[model samples]
Target: MKAPPHFIRNNEEWIIWLLEAEFSGSATPHALSSRTGISLDTIHDNFLYMERVGLLSIERDPDKRYPEEIARVNLTENSLRVYDELKIRPDPGDLF
Candidate 1:
């Protein structure tokens, strides 16, 4: 599936989710969606793309990616740093 127009609009949310997860010891898709407002569908789809592209690691639990076994959004060192500097959540009604 094609990503949402704004799915990659700002790298902040993506970076934050990954950084937060890495720092917090792993996170679920829900965490990323809640922070980014990218929608669960979008998150999963992009995650799959990330896996396909090998930017990060991806493991499935019966064809599903769960926090217990994997981080939905993986953060590289750069992403982690970007997230550390990023503040403020995206405004409501701006998720599209």
Candidate 2:
């Protein structure tokens, strides 16, 4: 399986994508930020970029009650292919 684009295959974004995939599209930007030590704004910005690149889908809450209740992020079909590739042969540094 071929890898994703360089930007999506990088550590930070890749980890976020992995986590979101693992959560079955229920992963929020705040959760990603907390887990990855990335700022909420940075996570949100990356989500938007990933969506634009066809790598992710971010569904904003229609209610939009709170700032933190933005939406859930999930990997797209194309992104899932990359996820499978990563699973088959993960980076050495990713082995924890």
Candidate 1 lDDT over 6-47, as tens digits, reads 333453445344446444624566666665566776666666
Could you tell me which residue pairs clash in candidate 2? Answer: none
Model 2 per-residue lDDT tens digits across residues 30-82:
76667667677777767777778888877788877544555887777877776
* Regions of model 2 farther than 4 Å from truth: 1-13, 62-69, 90-96
